[model samples]
Target: MPVRKLLSGLIGGMTPAGRFRHACRLLERADHSVRGFARLGQMAGSGMVAAQYQVACAYLDGIGVPRSPLEGMRWMHRAASAGHVEACFSLALMLLVDPPGQDGADSLLPTAWPEGIDAWPDPVAATHWAGQAARAGLPDAQALYGYLLATGPESVRDPEAAGIWCARAAQAGCPQGDLALAVNHLCAPDQPPGSNPGAVAALLRAAESGLPTAQYMLGLLHERGWGLSPDAAEAEKWYARAAAGGVRPAQARYGVMLLRNGRGNSRAIMAAETWLRRAALAGDREAAALLGDLHACGKAALPGDHEAVTWYRMAAEHDHAVACRMLALLYIQGRGVASDPDQARDWLQRAAVLGDVAAMTDLAATLLDRRDTPPATPAQAAAPLPDFRAMAQAGDPVAAFNLAVSLHRGVGCAADPAQAAMWMERAAEAGVVNAQYWYGRMLLAGEGISASPSQARHWLERAASHGLPEACIAAAQARLEGYGGPRDHAGALAFYHRAAEAGRGEAMFSLGAMYGGGHDVPPDRTQALHWFTRGAQAGNALAQFMLGRYLAQGLAGPVDRAQARHWLAQAVAGGVTAASAELDGMMLADDHAAP
Candidate 1:
């Protein structure tokens, strides 16, 4: 009962189905022999559906034949037309992965088509064949069909149908079906996305089934508390798994989380460095920038300076705005590189063009400072001014303040106090600290606006709350003098102390005067002497004069004329004319006492 003899004797008498069966047995027995392929090819040519499908697989996979996608698709199309389920599904998968008309698509995909078939791979045709196999009870086909319907082009998309097919495939134990359904649930536009326990469960199932993408998505859900409570440990676990599986984004996320939680842990920091380096090498721009930051700051066990420059340059070339600015700073400061102003300016311009506000401000300020071109006329003194006006109009608060200064000083434009006040107020409203202080001063002096002590006090106090030393002194003066409202000695004292703590010599002198003169409370000679000594050491002439007098009169601690003469001479050098007369009188008294 040799199959060759049986086929030779009964081939003409047997039906097409019987011929296909005999051909399959002959091929199995021949084991890739030339005769076996010839026989299979002959049966496939005779319109046998099963024989055609087998031939298609043989050509596609190069089993006992030279691989030919054209021949494979031709045979596959023939079998599919004859109602071969597997052949239909196979062709659909090929088309889905290498769609027609896409430039540089998979070269192995069918390029030439036989007559009467479509000339190119088409998603619509793929979907049709996938649907055919799905209805034929192929679980993988059902999952693919659902994915196509749910995520394909608008003309072919049908989410309702996709959901049904995905559910069917999932019930049949398809991990891809679960993944597709999970993504649909998590990304549904009409629903509150990412709050579904069912979606989380589906993703977990897919992730456990060894899908790297599913692991990454599950980690994101856990990190953000979508559909569950936020769990950093759980998120890190899944991200680590996905990262180990070669998921680039997962590697970056895992590294960032490790860094955030690893403050003093050397082992965790080292692990973070390893993962972030991998992600950076894989072309993850954020990961590269983050690595640059860690290296620049000497964190994550990375060698600083040179390593920071390398990472930052890589990210900057890829248009990372912050990285570009950081690299520019390194170049400007000559850290890990020779100082190059031109390179710094070029990088700064790149960062500014990429919408980095800090870079824009820095670049503008640098340009203003390095104006090598002399002004052609007094009216155009700041003619080549940096584009602060443009940046300010773009709502940059710092730029607005710079423009206000230019307008007030007639630097790059005509002096317009009214315009300056308007821009200054705008900058102050946007919370620019310097603008707030200047605007308050302007209001107090009526230089650019009406003198309004009440408004000045309000603005100065606002600036003082933000820790501006000059504003604190001004606010204290206003409070003590009752310039805008009722005098509040306690408030004035608090403001003066704040300014003095910030090392404002004027505030120190004011404090000494207030305590010595007993302006609001009983005079404390000891406190007066202490404040005067401190203010004098801080180079306040009035404070030096007062300290000299206090020593001469034995008011605070002692009558030390030697200390008095020393302080009075110091005050005379500091432009206190009264100290010279006091020193002269002391010398005269000393001369008479010597006799």
Candidate 2:
């Protein structure tokens, strides 16, 4: 007879307790049959602990029934409450992994649940059940309980107790127990040097058992030489294994190692790129930055600049300071994208805000030369001044120069010439070329500091050596006027010529005057007229006036009254009063000649 039929006949004459015992026997004898499962369910409903545990297992594992977590947890809780050891461990494990507020049978546990506690992990409840199973000599439960005690909430943490439980589990050959021991050892503080013997041994054992996290930790130990001689090859081997097992940090470290060891090898570069891209996509900023560098520099025959920009932008968006600056450089240089000063400035500012000192200096230089920048609203204009001042105070030379200019011109603050001179001199001493020129001018004019012709000439020459056009012109004037040293007309002419070739309108006018007046050279009216014409076309008011006068008198070449009038009108529009008076004289001459 089938076990279910035999049990049915035997239980009819028996008492209630005898019938219950017969039901348990039938459940065990009928094993995996559908009829046995049906009887087991009935017995579980009637408060049989073993039957409830078996029914829970069936629902959880989808054995001869439709799997349902709600039914599984309900029955598991019933068995666990009735002191089934395996049932208690199963319930704890389920509760430990379930997301907070989503535990299937939470409402059946307690009535005094704390309000607003859904955000916190309910490890304490899981620990309660795991403790009973752990004390019952379940190795897995011992390891879990020890880990929870070691790493759970402050109220339940007891490292000494955790160590004892983990030692027992480890002796029973549980891999997780070894991993827990390693974690505790690594996290211990104030350990004596060379004291990580247990951690290294435990990590090696766990890693050899194919644990990905243990493999990564073992790699770190080898790389850092924590408890052994540093071994790059050993570290690489472990990291490679962990990376293959999908450990993200291991992927990043493995890629970096491959890149370092395989420089100039195309196969190595490609392999490294694959792992780095994986880690970068998983939100590793360091990995993203390394990927950007590889592609940006055309490593492994990759399309360089465009791909670099893509990776750099990814890292930069996450506030990687170096990536932000590199992206800014790419934009400014038009590498793999159209040159956009605005985008470049935006990234540079972001990098500076992230405490990149080099970015702060570069940003200040870019802002100081925005003569053609699109107009911004008042709010946009005023927003960066405070930050600019801070950068200046933090010892950025270009920032100091920009702040001085801002103070002198009253762009974002009151005009303070004294402060401007002070900052300009500081920046000049710091080797800022523009600052050298401006500070020299301030000293020459005594605008905010005592006039010192000697110091002025020295700074002007310093700037002139760097080929600054304005500085050349200022240095020439100092030589011609004997402000600092003996007058040297030859030196003055040379400086004027240098500035004129660099397209300084003021320098062109000066050269024209020197040639026309025969200053330290033979008179050359033709050369004078040539420079004056070039200067006039370059929008120099004095050059326009001189060119008009020369045209009217025919001093350099043939006279042209119409051309003279045109030049005179241009000069007058440029605010040269002498040109207006000359135009009046020409009108009188025309009237006299017509009559």
Candidate 3:
């Protein structure tokens, strides 16, 4: 039997109350017919607010009547105008509700309206209806009215008025009202310190009512010791509760705390991973990047490069700069994927565009290499380059260094050594060790800057202390030549040894010259020959020339004409002017000795 018929038959000959009850029962049925609801609506009379509200709900949701929000809202407006409290509140809620796909505070106000309608869910209409409901003592309406007053259309944002309504709603047991009151007291920059007590009380009330955002805020307060003693344990407990309630930021914080402080507890580690994954899936980019790092580094029980790549890609697609840079490195090293320089460069470019300083530096180096040897694809050739001056001004040290290099070398830019020196100095001050060495060299050479031997040595020593081999060698030469300070052969020899140990070919050659000339210590022909051989093998053309001449004349050891010719030829290929003359002399000698 149809629900409407059954309900009508059962209620036949009953009292008026019974008829109304039966009508409501019929409307409540999931399969109730639209025509039957329309008949019941007529019988209930225009003055019956409950019946009108039910019919409006049915129309709005398409429960029995045809889905017509416009008609539903009209009926609701009629009931509300007749002083039905719930009808007023419901109308306000429908008007103020956010459109789908947006969530929480970021949700956009509804804009849809029925065909031929001028406006529906209008902010002004919502505020008017909400005000009526609030005046009727509805806590939810009071809270909503307060929020709308503070954050509605530009003309309606009255903070003082919002505070009054919010206080009334909170006193009447509205959780949202309590939250608003707490935020007003805590977050308003103009609020006095006296408001902290009220903010904490309001937050406590909301948290006790099981509001997740309130719990998260309380956790932050406890963790930061804001108006309370710092308590990590209490903070973690609140964070855990918030995370369980599906708060994304709370989930991330709780997961990170657990992972950092788990102390090898497998249960804590597992729980942390679960919460982090939940947060990551909920579109928390930082959580996704953290998960990627954990998996990449085999932490929190996640130990797979492929899994790391998946997480990094998720964050990277969301425009996470660090995650993109990490993905680039992984691709370049073939750690979790095939080594593809193109893919690596692509990811690096993405990260650089997202303002990753390290990525910008790496991308610049790659572009410079590509300039020397053209890239295979036009896309690679046309990849957008970062504005070095802009990035440098934005405090990227590597960008300052790169800009300096471009200016100094006139690579795609006008040569301006003065500007280059200025940029190099900026990079050096910003802690680029290589830039410090270069700036020191510029100072020593008076290259677009006044020569200051003392300043040159100062910067060189600083860079050397930071383990820059080239800076160490330069500092050693400065000491040996007494260019900046008093000559100290012993100090120079010590620096030379340090640089040589760090594989500086120039330092090795200097060591050989010191021993061969007996300038620093007593001459040692054996040590000189050993140092020259090592420097030559390390590609020092001057060392190769010296070694070849020494070997040919038997200066350090037994003469070996074959080795001398070989070293001289290698030195000539290395662009040593004296090596070329020596090789020619050997060729002439060979010709003279020929039969």
Candidate 4:
């Protein structure tokens, strides 16, 4: 039944156990002639226990009732104290979950009731109640105590004790305990490493007994080549049984498997998608992320979907890091949305706050360049200061390094080289690569810390070891020039290659110069032109000048006058004085040629 209808039945002046018994009688035609309300109204202790459990459900759901888990637990306690089998089962399930607060104190129940008042759920109390239920042929309580003994989590598992309880429950037709033993055998099977034949036999018996979990495990065993020969069709059959019993993961697996059987089923992806959505809705975090990715990529035919975005947004709201980063990027690039730099920065900040290192880096960059310029004021306009220091202090390594940069450069905050060095030191220690490079700089120059070339080289080496391009470039330059150590041109070349791939404009220009002049590398004007053109387009002034020279001399690719003039103009604009002079000379020559 829908939970709403169940709640209404309770609120309409019907007792829980009475209603259950009535429903069972009506369904089964067991012909119990007890007057429903009269019997309940005249009921003694045992009868009230049913009403208490029903009222507990009403309180728990708040559908035609007031939502109150604590109240539910209280009533559950009442029924449990009366030696109710269902109440004991409910109590066991509730205890397995988080405890509800009681009497204004943070705990589940008031230290147990019914079994042993002063010693509730203690070894003795749990054993006594569980023993009574086990002997009385109750299934779930037997399953619980059997599990405790079988796993030995709180106490040692007496296999003999476990066997006795499991046998009783199995005889009572409780599939769960049998399934539990089956699972225990599957995981540890042999007492040590290899497969346990005894455990496999136990699982097969449990599967035959209609235990859904066992069926699923048996499906996994067949799906893999474990104990059984690998068989997709056989696995699907077991999975179907588990799904029929309402196991969420099994439902998903079975649905996807049926979908994949393409002889008649071409809707495998769709079926998988539906099951994934169901799992996501049922509070599976990984399912939410997977569904979001499918939607985002259109693999689920959900193109241009904010449905995935909404899922991600919901997950992010619930504090998922990957979801936070996804939202952060959407805001950062203004993808299919209005660009709001502050909102972008805020999202990035949230991701950083959640300890995402990449998000921290992006957040630091955004904070340092906040486009939060309120329209040019008629009064003095104070510069927008980056506030990533707070996050840095909160232990974000990237934020720490960024805060240090702001302090060192006075970009968005006051210049305090000392503080900058301190934060940079912290960030470097925390494993941020660039922080190591900058930390080295501070040590070398005595800009923030005491000057020590050796310490500078040490930190630079650390950064370089991690393949930090900028650090590599700087370290290679220092080494090749014999500033901190002996010249190593080979190291310089390797560093240049690393920096160039990372899109460093100056490194590309330097590589082109090396190739063009054949100073250290073999002369190759074709390669030089390629690097020079790439660097020039990226706004490197020297590269622009070099590209213009190559075009004028026809030393690399054939170039038209239009291309040469464009590069010359760019070089001049970038403050290359020689390019400016050459532009004037070329203009004079062009005028002379025209005359």
Which candidate leads the pack in TM-score?
3
Go through the candidates in order and give each one's C-alpha lDDT. Answer: 0.82, 0.81, 0.80, 0.68
Residues 1-595, candidate 2: write the lDDT tens digits: 8998996687677875565565555545536445557877887898878889988887776566766666777788789888898988887787777532354544433233333223223678778778888999998898888887888777878889988888888889988888877776666565642367876787788899998988998888888887878999999999999999999999999999998899778888889989999999988888998888877665744746678888999999999998998888666645556456789889998999999977876675566557346546665566464445787788878778888887777766788999999999989999877789999999999978999999999999888765567788889999998988889888988888767765677888998998998577667889899999999998899999999999999999999999999999999999999899999999999999995
Candidate 4 ranges with C-alpha deviation above 4 Å = 1-34, 45-87, 94-131, 148-164, 171-173, 186-194, 223-230, 252-266, 317-320, 335-595
**Stronger candidate by lDDT (1 vs 2):** 1
Candidate 1 global lDDT: 0.82
State in Å the error of residue 290, model 4: 1.3
Encode model 3's per-residue lDDT on 1-595: one tens digit a residue: 9998997687687876666677777777776565548656875465677777777777677777766666677677777777788888887787676432345432333345444223654787788888898998999888888878877887777788888998999999899888777766664568642247876888888888999998988888888887667888988999999998889999999998898789868888888889999999999989999989887766747567677888899999999999998887666544456445688789998998999988888677557646677777887778666568887888888788888887887766898999999999999998777689889999999997999999999899887764456777889889998988988787788788767765667888899998897586778878889888999998998889889998999998899999999999888888898888888898899899999
Instruction: Give residue 521's error in model 1 in angstroms.
Output: 63
Q: What is candidate 1's lDDT per residue for 426-531, written digit by digit as tens?
A: 9999976657878999999997899988988888888776556778888998999998878987788888876776566777888888888768856777888888
Q: What are the clashing pairs of model 4?
A: 259-268
Candidate with maximal lDDT = 1
Per-residue accuracy of model 4 over 233-261 as CA lDDT, tens digit each = 99899988887776667766765576467
Q: How many backbone collisions does model 4 have?
A: 1
Residue 298 lDDT (model 3): 66
Q: What does candidate 3 score on TM?
A: 0.56
Alpha-carbon shift of residue 469 in model 2 (angstroms): 26
The candidates, ranked best first by TM-score, are: 3, 1, 2, 4
- Total clashing residue pairs per candidate? 0, 0, 0, 1
TM-scores of the models, in the order given: 0.53, 0.53, 0.56, 0.46
For every candidate in turn, the CA RMSD to the true structure comes to 18.4, 15.9, 15.2, 17.2
Off by over 4 Å in 2: 1-121, 124-126, 192-194, 313-321, 324-595
